[model samples]
Target chain A: SAVISQKPSRDICQRGTSLTIQCQVDSQVTMMFWYRQQPGQSLTLIATANQGSEATYESGFVIDKFPISRPNLTFSTLTVSNMSPEDSSIYLCSVAPRLGNTQYFGPGTRLTVL
Target chain B: TQLLEQSPQFLSIQEGENLTVYCNSSSVFSSLQWYRQEPGEGPVLLVTVVTGGEVKKLKRLTFQFGDARKDSSLHITAAQPGDTGLYLCAGVGHNNAGNMLTFGGGTRLMVKP
Candidate 1:
């Protein structure tokens, strides 16, 4: 399992602002994914971030709203732009290491949009 | 697009009781994984069942995959208050990403001592 960490474990932001969540993995990985878990809901894939390429957003998720950056194999960032109350959710980053089909997740960034 | 439906959306049981949680899907999955999540923390993977009709046990928790690969079940024996948490079932999807996961609605379990 990879040791993953997300910065600013929790945050409070006003509507219309943006916050960038960083995910750092202990080892270099090729596949990094961002997922959102709404209050009392399941996890939904927001995007797939691969280093040296553009992030692929999932259905109903626009790149404009959830911009992602995979600057390196071990680090990625997801920026929630133009936030709204509906965007209040736990944002998590997962890494699929080179060895297996399993993924390891970060503690998650809990965002509260006011 | 595949979807996984979890049964008994919420379960509250007393300690020492046994309970089962189900995850069903109309579409087959290449693999299924079970995870337990506590407040303010990310889900911790419990077990992964790949082959159909396979059963794996971890301590007091048992995980089984259906023969058709479209369903799975998790049974815990002699449950303890420490077992209380949100249980999630995720199926591995065949996608370009290779390991894309389709998560179930999730079962929130509360065990009272």
Candidate 2:
């Protein structure tokens, strides 16, 4: 199992401000993913953070709003730019096991835009 | 678009009661996973069903995949307070490999003492 750590466990940002969340994995991983979970809702995949490449985002999401970067196999960052109250949600980073597709997730970053 | 539809969006029951959550889709998948997430924590993998008609048991939880690989179910026997959380089912898209996952809306189960 892989352990992941995310910085800024909780933050209160003013509207229009930007916040970057960092994810650091204890070991190298083949795949890393970013997810968002609204209060009382399930998790939604935001993008797939690729090593040395632009993240692949899902429908209803765009890179300009939620820019992501995977500098290496064990590290990635997600920046929520021009934030609004609606963007307040728990952001999580996950690392997938090499052999199977099982994912290990970070504790999560809870952001509340005021 | 691939989607997983889960039933009973919210459930509340007394401890020791039994309940089952369903996850269905029109598309087939190579693998399906069950996860339970607490209030402020990321989801924890409960079990993974990879083959059609597969059944896996973890403690008091039982997971079953449909014969067609288009659906799955989770049954909890003798529920406890710790069982209260958001239950989610995710599957790998049939056409994609590790690219994306279609997650069920989720079943929020609250077990009362």
TM-score of each: 0.98, 0.96
For all candidates, the clash counts are 0, 0
Model 2 lDDT at residue B40: 72
- Model 1 C-alpha lDDT per residue in residues A1-114, reported as the tens digit of each score: 799999979999999999999999999887899999999988999989978888888899998999999999999999999999999999999999863468888999999999
* Decoy 1 TM-score against native: 0.98
* Clash pairs, model 2 backbone: none
Q: Which candidate is the best by TM-score?
A: 1
Per-residue lDDT over B6-79 for candidate 2, one digit per residue giving the tens place of the 0 to 100 score: 99899999999999999999988888989998877888888889899999999999999999999999999999
lDDT of 1 by residue, B1-113 (tens): 89999988999999999999999999999899999999999988999999999999999999999999999999999999999999999998856655688999999999999
True contacts kept of 2: 0.63
Give the Cα error of residue A4 in candidate 2, in Å: 0.7
Score residue A8 of candidate 1 by CA lDDT.
77
Please tell me how candidate 2 rates in CAPRI terms. Answer: medium
CA lDDT of each prediction against the hidden true structure: 0.93, 0.90
Model 2, position B18, has a per-residue lDDT of: 99
DockQ of candidate 2, scored on C-alphas against the true complex (2 decimals): 0.61
